[model samples]
Structures are given as structure tokens and as C-alpha cells.
Target: MQNLQAKGLSALVAISILFAGTGCQSNSASATPPESSKTLDTAPATAAPAELPIISERAPTPMGEESVRGAPADPSAGTALAQLETIAIKGRAPKTGYDRDVFGQGWKDLDRNGCDARNDILNRDLTNTVHKPGTHRCVVASGVLADPFTATTIHFVRGNATSTAVQIDHVVPLSDAWQKGAQQLVPEQREAFGNDPLNLLATDGPTNGAKSDGDAATWLPPNKSFRCEYVAIQTAVKAKYGLWMTQAEHDAIQRILTSSCPDQPVPTDEGGVAVPIAAEPAPVPETVQDTPTAPVPGPVSGPDVVYKNCTAVRSAGVAPIRVGDPGWDTKFDRDGDGVGCE
Candidate 1:
């Protein structure tokens, strides 16, 4: 009976030892997971490096040639802002020796288009224009102007009483140009600068007068919407004529271009070609009547005659003094067709 009892005890001890070994192997296997399971646990860490490319892709690249140091690259190459960067800044010169005649006596036919500068601008800017009957459409008899200075529609009629209502405004006023860099230009160049179509605008007469001799620093268009275009035109003119701007003027123009129209291009057109300044025609002899009675009824024949007004011209019997005729003057040429008292 003792032997049998001992055998049972031995069997029980062996079973206990087997169960302990199995538990140890199971713990070892669980502590070290499979290679695929380990990769899944570290998946988030691996994904971190993938985001680096996305960040680098958003960086800005340079455009065209490199710009001036410390300045932002031009949004577009050859834009007004880029052009503005090229212009020189300087103090304004004196107005000494400045005169309207220095630019030339009056509007000239610089374009050689069979029309004077004033009439050309009038024809170009005014809508629905009606020209005089015998002026080959060179004369703007009547028209509607979308005046940029005042931002209003103006009815333009060719007459002494109403012609002044829509006057041609120089984008860079003559006096302002004279003070900037025009004094150095030759007479032909100055004349071309004065008559260039790119510099002319048919604006409200009062506005033109108000803006007389004012630069971008001193004056701007009353029409806020047109201010960008106005400044752009001024910049182009100054650049074309090799004119410099005051610090204030340059800053004003730069402010407008950057804040309002960053991409505005410098305006381009057929600029005036320099031509030889024509000499004044020789004066013709006046046939004075010994008895100075009522003025004779016909065209006046004396270059020295200065009529006070169109009515005076009529009283002198020179109701229609064609351009180049004796006694002809721009003041009498209300329609600006190179004809006076018509």
C-alpha cells in the first residue's frame, strides 16, 4: 500500500512541473510580438517624415530677374511698379524762363495727321463726335466726353462761349514738366512733350485750371476710380520724357500703384515725334482806308490786327479767319481746328 501511495505522489509532481514550463514559454512568446505587429505599433512615427515635402512645396519662388535688395519682387515683370523702381527721384527745378511759348505758340500738328494736337485729343477722347462741315473731320464740332477728372459726362460744343468747358489737360502739366526735367530738353523735344497725345486728356475746364502746374504730390483726379490710371499715365509720360519726380511725388505715385493697382502696366501709345520748330510767318501789309469808316465787310488782311473777341472780329468784317490767315490766333480759334472766327 505504501508503494502505490508513493507512485501516485510521483505522478502528481511530474504533472505540476509540466504545467510550470508551459506557463514560462507562453510569457516569453507574448513579450516579443511578431515583426508585422511591431511595425504597426510604430506606424505614427514613420508618418512624421512624409509631411516635410508638403511644407517645402508652399514656399514662394522668385520670378523673372532678381529685384532690388530688400524690395519685394514685382508681382509681374515689366509692370508699372517695376518701371517706377527705375525712375530717378530728385528735387524740382526752378520755373525761371518758363513760358507757354517756350513749349510752342499753341497746339501743333506734331503727329502730321492733318490735325492740330488740341483737335486730335478732342476727337480721340470725345464720344459720338460731330466734326465741322469743311474741316475733314479734323474739327470736333460737338461731342460727349466722359471726363476723367470730374467723373462726369460733359457735352462739348465748338464755340467761343462753350469750347472752354472741355479743355485739354496735360497729364504732366507744362509748368510741372518745366520744373522737373523739361528745361534741359531742346525746343523740338519740349514741343513734342507738350503735344504728345499720351499726356493729353479732355477734362473739365475748371478741373484743368485747378490742376494747373500741380504734380502727383500736389493734385490728383477727383475721380477715385480713375486715380490709378491717371497716375500710371503720369508715370509713363515722365519716364518717356526723361523727367524726374520729387520725393513726395514719387512716394505718392508708388503708394497709389502698390495699394490700388499692383499690376497696372505703364500706358503705351504713339508718342509725339520731335519736329523742327516752324518760324512765324511774315506779317502782311494792311491796306488802311484813309477815311476809317465802318470796317470793310471781308476777311482781314493784316497779321498785326488783334481782335478783342469774335464779335470784334465780326465788326472788323473778318467773321471767318481761317488758320494761317492774317489776324489769326488760338483765342479766336474756339473750335481749335486751326481756324479762327468761323
Candidate 2:
């Protein structure tokens, strides 16, 4: 337990280093300084550390208080936002919800550093990442994945290089992020949300995909064992950005903590890594010229829904769901995860 605790702390520190790299609030615009940028000012002249420590247990940070870094309150109320959007993609939300293109064509590689955050995290997480010389982007090979998911240290061989094995999961998925106030961000901050090193971690790709865009309330790691840590991580991210969760989302998290460690703390986002905490109350912007609306689709239904309570769904399956079936409107398709049977 002590060793795990140490590793957790070390990991949190490692996350801090990453966030510290971009300096919190990675805005593309230079209107004001970002939290992470300030660290840049204070970090010694030496190069950044090769690696940093991690932490465990998210201590629910008190509301309205200054964190050690003096992070400011969510500024600008973010830029004006249109109808909020959510990802309807398959699999789960990528560990690091970043896409240079999402914020517009070229922000991820800012310094033209070929090794973008994705590759950087891969290089750090994988056993032997075959990288492009100076930039580190061109990942020709990936090393074994060595990290603990729950009590198990996940070990992957070189042959199992599927990203599902070495994914960069956002501590907080982007869709859940949008719901939690990410929609308020100025365009630049939204782009940073996709790539900021602070919110990402090399995690199980498939599980990451499965989590998709659901929030802590709707989904969790397949490994039910890690629920506490996952919720703690989610809490940290939401708290860090001063994002607010729907009452349902908050209730979902409370359920998990009660089911797991009822006394867990809210954790910290000092870095992207998630930590556990005793217990506490529950808890991005981006801009761009008006791109065509993403076409708000209707809510999901029938076979497309993944109900939190599968039994409840199965019981109602006798009538079954069919396309355009009038009452098909109701049924287990409530949240619409698309796999009601499962």
C-alpha cells in the first residue's frame, strides 16, 4: 500500500510537470498569462525533468480558495457559445480528448515540435517508442505498457501495440467536459483542452474508447475495481476547470464513492494525473469563426442505448425495439449508449 501510495504521489507530480509544461490555461491567444505559463517563468533555466512523480487520492479542493499556484477563477466566462455539442462516436472518449483539427488546423504542434502531446505521452508510457529524431513524433514502434490499472500492473508486450493498449485518456472526457462548462471556453482554451498535457494519461485504449463521451455518472472503467480512482480523477478535472456538473452527474459520482470509498476526497488537478481524497461535496472554451453547425442529432434509442441498469432494460425487451417503432421512443434507450442488451 505504501509503495502504491508513493507511486500515486510520484505520478501526480509527473502530471504536474506536464501541466507545468504548458502552464495551466493554455490559451492560444496571449491576452493574459495562463497558470501553466507562470510556472514557466519560475521553473529553473534548466531543461524540464525527464519524468516527474505521481499522486493518489484527490483532496476535494475547497471552493473559492486559492490553490498553491494561485489559479484564478474561470475567467471571461469563456467566449460566447452556440448550442452545446456532444460526440456521438463509437468506442470511448480518447484518453486525451485532443485533436488539433477540432480547435482548427494547427495548434497542437505549436513550436512545430513534431512530437505532439499524443506522441510525447506514448513515448513516456510505452516501453520502447521508436521516435523521429529531434521532434519525437514519427512513432515507428511502441514499448511495452507498464502501469497499474487497479491492483494489477498492466504489462503489455511490444507486439500488442494497439493504441487501445497505450491510449492517452483525458482524465475527463471532452463530451462530459463540454457539459461541465467546457462550452464556455474561448476558442483557444478549447483547443488546449484537446491537447494540454495536463488532462491526459496513458491508459487502456479499449476501456478509454468504451468510456466514450459519458461523464463519471454515466460510465466508468470496465474494470469495476477502479471506480473510486476514476471518479476521483473526474472530480479533479471538473474542479480544476471550475466546471459544474449536472445534479444527475454529481449524484452518479456520489453513488460511486459510496459504493467504493465513501470518504474519498475531491482530488487535485495540480497535474493531469488523478488522486484519491477523503470525501467532499460534489462539484473550457474554445472559439473559431462560425464553422457550420455540427448538426445536432436527436437523442439515441433502441439498440444504440447502453443502459446503466441492463437488467431494467432486459425486462422491457419482450416488446423489443424496432426502427421507427412509435413507442420505441421510450424504453431502455434513455441515455442512449446503444447497447441496451449489454
Candidate 3:
């Protein structure tokens, strides 16, 4: 009886040992996590933040003078449609205190090319150009303009009566700019804005007149094919000058760009923002004892000194010849302000 009882105890001990070994193996397997659980355990603590909203792309709220001053140097680097996205949309400002003189007396030689902005654009946009004989090609005597606004071929003759046939149209008109953000620009910047060739185009005079002070919402080139380029040019100008657009204007430009010419590139050119340098005032000469000298002859009056044109007059060191001065002719006084070639 004692031997049998001992055998049962031994069998029970063996079974317990086997069960313990199986539990040890199971615990070893569980010590290393399953592949799926391992992946979950090693995963990043947090997801990447969601992309910032599109609202961040807009100009700062309450766009101020600094906004106008922060124009990009090369606003034409991108597609016009994409560039339009960067411009601010705002209501037009009051037109008070706005005048042609607010920009400058007239076209300036901002490029310092020895020619005014008017002639520069004329030379640039016109074909078969004929420059004045002695003007070093500074003065455009005549040219043929493929007028974009009217989609017509127009002859441009530089004369008081005929010059108006082809006029330089401001892609973004001065008044429109003033009402937009130009009111915040300094005088020099305003002058630069007025003369920027990127904003100027040679177009049909009557058509330009019809587009006076009008934005894309109000004016578009009559030629349907040119509208895309026209809007693109306007967008480029506004972007270049840090000028804002009205919501209507923005919408109009957006519609044209998206619907018609999605790939339209901003017209990039050598012509850029050219601010005119102010001429330094001549230093005051030291006073000295007067020496006996011959009386300087006053400007010759009447037609005795006949000048073919203003170029000849300037060459003779007698520009701005007054109405009664020699070589003075009504033809030379384009503005008819009694001053010829002033």
C-alpha cells in the first residue's frame, strides 16, 4: 500500500512539472509583442499637424501703408492666375485730392533713357517705327500700332493734332490706382507707378478714353482674344505696385484667367519699377567782385532762329522756348501752355 501511494505522488509531481514548463514557454512567447501590436507600440505619438488653412495666404487684415510698400520685386514670376491670389481685395478709397499732377506733370524719363516714358512705350509697342531725324531716336515721329484694346491697326503720327490717334494707356489707370492704394505711396513712388512701362501700353486713343479709370470689372479689351493678356497685364501691374483691387475687379480677373487662359503668364520684361531720381540743386556760387563783361544777348525773338523741331532747339541750348521766343511755334507747344518743348 505504501509503494502504490508513493507512485501516485510521483505521477502528480511529474504532471505539475510539465504544466509549469508549458506556462514558462507561453510567457516567453508573450514577452515579445505580436507584429501588429509592435507596430502600434512603435508608432509616432502624434500625427503631423493638418496643413494650415488657405486663409493664411491672404494679405494681413486691415491692410495698411506697409502692405502697399511691400510689393514683390518680380511679381511677374508666376502664372497670372496664381499671382492674382496674392493681391488684396478692398473697397475703393475716396477720390479726393487726386489729380494728374499728383503723379507728375507728365510722362517722366524714369528709365533715364534720354527719352520720356511716352516715347519709350511708343517705341516698344509700335512697329515700323520712324524716329525723328536729329532726336537720336528719342522722339517717335511715326509708327504702326497693333492696338490691343481695339484689335485694329492704327497709324501713330507724332503731332499735336494726330498724336492723339494713338495714346499710351495706363493698364491700371492713375485714378484707379489712387482709389486703390496709391494714396499711401510717396510722391516719388507715385511718379514711378505712373511711368512704369509694365503698366503702360500703346492702344487706340478712343478706346483708351473709353477705359479711363476703369478696372477689369468695368473695362476689358474689345478683342476677345486679347482680354486674357489684358487682364494678365493688369494683374501683374497691381501685384508689382502692391496695389489692391476691388472685389469686383478681383472676381473679373479671376473669371477671365480661370475660364479663358489658365496658363497665361505674367508679362515679365526688362521694364520695371523705375523711380525718378530727383536732380540735385546746383550749389550756390561764391560771390565775387564783378568784372567788366559784355551784356549777354537776350533770347532772340520772332522766327529769326528757325528750329526744325524741339530737338534742334534743345541742341542749341535753348529748350523751353517761350511763345514769343525765336523758333517758338504752336506745333512745338503740345500742351499749348505758351511754352514750347518745356
Candidate 4:
């Protein structure tokens, strides 16, 4: 009985040892997951890179090259750049008495290529063009426009509403021109400035409207690729028209041209034909009075009143005549102080 009890105790001890081994194996398995899964959990995550803007089909032309439409190339790239350097930098003049009529009837056929300026531009710039029937190509019917300002592809059809989709832009706006020395120009020169193709562009209408009369300092095309070209065009126009730039405008333009378009060109050549001036009618000679009327003049006489100098007027007892007085002449009023003498 003692031998049997000792055997049973040994069996019980073996079973306990087996149970202990099984527990250790289970703990080991629980502590370690699969190596593949461990690597996946610990590995660093990578984020996707941002997408870049897509380049457009309407890439800007280089400084030396011509833009869409019959826009002329610079006379010489170096010459164009030199002209830009020559522009006078000055503060803008007040926009007093500035009107569209001051420039001339809008969009005259100054070039008179048998087509109006608007149609000429559309014909020159628009691709896959369809002209209006019975109008001798004076009107654009439909076309595709790859606008440089926003890099937008526009399908244009001529209509009251649709025609506004594309507009002819004055690269240098007339109002901007008015403030930049255009006020000093004669009527004909102002007209030339307005209608010059080198100063014009066909662009998206909204972009043009947004850029209304804004100089380089105020506005630039949104298309990164076109900004350089836009600056070049503005520089060329200002230089060609003998207009000056504000200090801020000059600096901004300089940065753009020097940084991106170092080889920028100017359109110094007049792209359009001379506007015709009607000859003045010959002056009709005043009918000579057969009988000379007795001199009824008072205070101022005919030949003596026309004093060549202030000294002559002073000598004639008309020392200081107000601006509205008969003896007050601009020649004598050097200072324009409303009084002829001193």
C-alpha cells in the first residue's frame, strides 16, 4: 500500500510539470506577434505629395516673339529693353478731364486694312475662325480662344451675351495712359495710342475687366507663365507712347522682367497705318469795308491794344489788366496770375 501511494505521488508531480511547461509556452506565444505584422505596425507612414499646376496650351510667347493676333515683334530685343530703361519714372498726374472722347471715337480703323480694328484683332487672334455671312468678314462668328491671362480655353460665339466673353484689351489702358503723360499728347497722337495693335491684346473679358486701368503695380495676370509676358507688353507700350511710370510701377515691372523675362522686347514700331486728317478749308478773306467807319473804340484800340510786350502795355497806361480785360494777353501774362503786369 505504501509503494502504490509513492507511485501515485510521482505521477501527480509529472502532471504538474507538464502543466507548468504548457503555461510557459502559451505566455511566449502571447508576447510575440508575427514578424510581418510587427513590421507593418511600426513602419512610418508616408503622405502623398501635392499636385502641381498643369501647364497650359496657351504658353506665353517669349519677349522677342509676337503674341496672338497680328501683334508685331519688337524691333530688336536689345533695343526693346533699352527703350524700357529710358522711360521716365514720375508720379502719376491727376485724371482730371479724362474722357473716352478725348482719345478719339473708340476703335477707329486707323490702320484701315479694309477691316475695323476689333475685327482685325479677332481675325488675327482667334483660331478655327468663322466669319459672319454677307458682312465681308467684318464680324467674327465663332472661334476658339486660348486666353493668356487665366490660361483658359474659351469657345466664343458672336452674340449680344456671348460677345462679351472675349474683349480687346488695351495692354496699357487709356485711363492709365491719360495719367502717364498722354494728357500732353495732341488729339491725333492720343488716337494712335488708343488703336495701336502693339498696345492691344485679345483676352478673357473678365480678366480684362478686372484689370481695368491698373498699372503693373496694381494688377498682373494670374497665370504664372503669362506674368512675364504681360509685364513685357506693358513696358513696351509705356515706352512706345512716351509715357512715364510711377516709382512703384517701375520697380514692379523691373522685378518681373529681370527675374523671369530678362530678354523682354519692346514694340517700338508703329503697327498701324497713319490716320487720315481732313485738310482744313482755305480761310475766306474778310470783305474789305469800302467806307472806313470812324474809330469808335474805347479803352483799347485795334493795333495799339495788341501789345507785344508788358513794357508796351505799361507804357500805354494799361499797367495791370485783369485776365478778362481787353489788353490782357497771354504773352504779357508770363505768370498767369490773372493780371497782365506783375
Query: Which one is best on lDDT?
Result: 3
The alpha-carbon RMSD values of the candidates against the true structure, listed in the order shown, are 16.8, 27.7, 18.4, 19.0
**Tens-digit lDDT string for candidate 1 (77-114):** 35777778777787766565666557876688876767
Sequence-dependent TM-score of model 2:
0.43
- State model 3's lDDT: 0.72
Please say which candidate is ahead in lDDT: 1 or 3.
Answer: 3
Q: Give the Cα-based TM-score of candidate 3 against the true structure.
A: 0.60
Model 1: per-residue Cα lDDT at residue 307: 77
What are the per-residue Cα lDDT tens digits for candidate 3 across 1-342?
999999999999999999999999899888988888988899778888899754212122111112111134454487899999999887776665666657877678776767777777777777677877886776778878878877888987877567767877888888788877777777787889888888888888778766756788878888898998888888888887777887888999999999999988777645645544435422222222222222324555555778887656755656545556667778776543344543
On TM-score, who's better, 2 or 4?
4
lDDT of each: 0.71, 0.46, 0.72, 0.67
Question: What lDDT score is found at residue 96 in candidate 3?
Answer: 57
For model 2, the local distance difference test gives 0.46
Where does candidate 4 stray beyond 4 Å?
Answer: 1-80, 267-270, 273-342
What's model 4's TM-score?
A: 0.59
**Any idea how many clashes model 1 has?**
0
The regions of model 2 sitting more than 4 angstroms off are: 1-114, 128-140, 147-161, 262-342
Superposition error at 53 for model 3 (Å)? 46
lDDT of 2 by residue, 1-342 (tens): 999999999999999899877865465446566689877887678875677556322222222122222133233322111001111122222223332234333225332345455544554445443443453233424455544243334443223223334456776766556544555555555666666545666676556555655676567666676676566656655555556655556667777766667655443334232222314433223323222224333444555654343333333432223224323433433212221121
